[model samples]
Target: MKNKLLKITTNLWFDTQAEEAARFYTSIFENSKIGRTTYYGKAGREIHGMSEETVMTIEFELEGQTFVALNGGPHFKFTEAISFIIHCESQEDVDYYWEKLSQGGDEKAQACGWLKDQFGVSWQIIPENITDMINDTDPDRSARVMTALYQMKKIDINTLKLAYNE
Candidate 1:
């Protein structure tokens, strides 16, 4: 074995719906595509104790991130601890993603301008200036922004700024 790795990969465990999930996700993102779906043949069945031609794994890419969706049976579930945050420069971007990702999942407001989509995925729909405002030297302004963020499900950058001025 060589002490070298080409790319970082994330393995997602699905409950016999890896192929379906992969297609759904690829449709949502622009630069997304389903790479390949390998099936387990009879030989694989003997080794893994499963039926032949079943979906063993699926590879897909979303926003340049390569992910492998494994139909490894439902042993685990997704949690908010690990989430993909999409930074938005405008309200349109926020609306586009929020509407799509929130489908068929629960929605929850998170502190400091974040939202959890239907699939238990946490997304921080943040504005470009949010980073600067949060890092500002004024503690009062920062506190105001934090307070404003807590009052809403979807982040409104303009509202947060107004709170900071107050």
Candidate 2:
């Protein structure tokens, strides 16, 4: 019944921190929760190199989006090719998520509103309407916005707006 109540869900492969990651993710967003948890049986243990009764997977919902975390092993890792984009409405949201997600994460990856969290997951904490603002019909304004954006790490919406208006 793992698929219940979900049309499509993102499955994140983890070494052994499925439950812990699920909890951390749920704590970050509103309308989030740590859902069902599955464990490894004897057969599962043999196949996955995990012990019996060990955590196998964790199901979680972050802001109504479903996600599954599997304790598969170190065979798979997260890359920047795929990232979760958080569309923020205000500077507070951008600041909060940026601070929280990148707490123990990679500071080196912090550029242009993108940061890699401690879990090795990449996140784009961006302000809403940024696409519209940056893609404005005015070429000069658009160029300015792009320049401002390229210089930012955790996107400052106010600064972007100022760049757009200026």
Candidate 3:
């Protein structure tokens, strides 16, 4: 099979833990790697006020998706408004990622399979079936699934299936 060219890459902003965050993410997901590591230079110091020799960015790829993690200082922070969605193949897959991604993060922010990682970056560990179930032709069935989903922190595929049937 031929590899397709990647057209879009997501950029992540971090205060000072860009490398750490990249390492942590690559550890959790398969087919991921921490790529080129760059440092701030004298030119960067004048622009971003970061000390020369500090980590400027980390180029990484996670589950085939490319990304750049920036140590761009504390002027910016992640919000729930934007989140990376992990489309899981099974209940076990969801469980595995949810646990890993949520560690050292705000437990209080976990709901509807959405969680904030240690770096405050939001992620949604979703089961593949959830989207199909929630979009069922029967509105009541879908609504029930949505209600069940809202009540739980980590999404349970079995529970979601049960709700869809109900």
Q: Find the candidate with the highest lDDT and give its number.
A: 3
Q: What TM-score does each of the candidates earn?
A: 0.83, 0.94, 0.93
Off by over 4 Å in 1: 1-6, 43-50, 108-118
Q: Predicted candidate 3: what Cα RMSD to the true structure? A: 3.0
Comparing 2 and 3 on lDDT, the stronger one? 3
Error of 3 at 47 (Å): 2.8
Q: For candidate 3, what is the lDDT?
A: 0.93
Give per-residue CA lDDT, model 1, range 110-164, as digits (tens).
5555656544556666787787877779998888887787777777767987987
Q: What tens-digit string does per-residue lDDT give for candidate 3 at 54-149?
A: 999999999889999999999999999999999999989999999999999999999999999999999999997788888889999999999999
Clashing pairs in 2: none
Give the 10-residue window scoring lowest on summed lDDT in candidate 3. Answer: 1-10
Per residue, candidate 2 scores C-alpha lDDT tens digits across 34-70 of 8889999888555689988888989999988999999
**Regions more than 4 Å wrong, model 2:** 1-6
Ranking by TM-score: 2, 3, 1
Return whichever of 1 and 2 wins on lDDT.
2
Q: Tell me the RMSD of model 2 versus the true structure.
A: 3.1
Query: Candidates 1 and 3: which is better by TM-score?
Result: 3
C-alpha lDDT (0 to 100) for residue 53 of candidate 1: 82
